[model samples]
Target: MKVRVGFGYDVHALVPERDLWLGGVKIEHTMGLQGHSDADVLIHAICDALLGAANMRDIGYHFPDTAGEYKDIDSKILLFDTMELLRDAGYTLGNIDATVAAERPKLNPHIPEMKRVMADVLQVDVEDISIKATTTEKLGFTGRQEGIAAYATVLIQK
Candidate 1:
């Protein structure tokens, strides 16, 4: 089997009134991420990682923000489509490990649900998807709660 590894990172500004979507589930928060889509930072990162591992280019290339069809679209749909692209290219996901950086709203409590949702979208075992969160030690944009960011690394095989 041929195995490949890839890494991805993404960030979105937080703003009031918008719904906070992470991984593939909604989290109650005073602020939500700003983006053309639902702005699921974790999912975007995972998508990029998977695509990169397959040497298929990045997420924005495949799913452009300029497209009207994607406006405020569900990120889970994008994740599902990304998997289809990978499968069509003769690649299968092995596992994913990801981390979200945030300052407030306590991400730990939501991790299990995030993992479940992401696993379902990727059609992988829940154990194959690992979601971790950190506070950034109150040291950066994430620490100040200006935005949220996520990093993901994935392994894929053919």
Candidate 2:
């Protein structure tokens, strides 16, 4: 068996009049992350991590923001597509650990749902995916509530 590891990071600015999406679950918040897609930073990071582990290109290489088809697209679709890419390459997921950083709306309460939702999309057991949420201690953009960020690490094997 061949095993590989990959890591991914993503950030999006918070903006009004948008829904906050993370790990395929929507959270009620005053502001949402802005992006060409639904701006689910957690899913994007996980997609990148999976692609990197498979030695495939990043998410943007597969799903370009320049494409109108992706405008306001659901990040869960992107995760499903990413999984398909890995499946095509004969790579199966071993595990995933992801973290989200934010200063408001308190993400911990929503983590379980996020894990279940993302695991369903990835076609893995909920145990195979771990999601964590934290505050940046009022230091940076996330700390200042200007944006949200996510990081993900994945293991894949063939």
lDDT to native, each model: 0.94, 0.94
- Write down the TM-score of every candidate: 0.98, 0.99
Off by over 4 Å in 1: none
Mark the regions of model 2 whose C-alpha exceeds 4 Å error after superposition. Answer: none
Question: Which lDDT tens digits does candidate 1 get at residues 60-101?
Answer: 999999999999999999999999999999999999999999
Query: Residue 17 in candidate 2 has what lDDT?
Result: 96
Clashing pairs in 1: none
Model 1 C-alpha lDDT versus the unseen true structure: 0.94
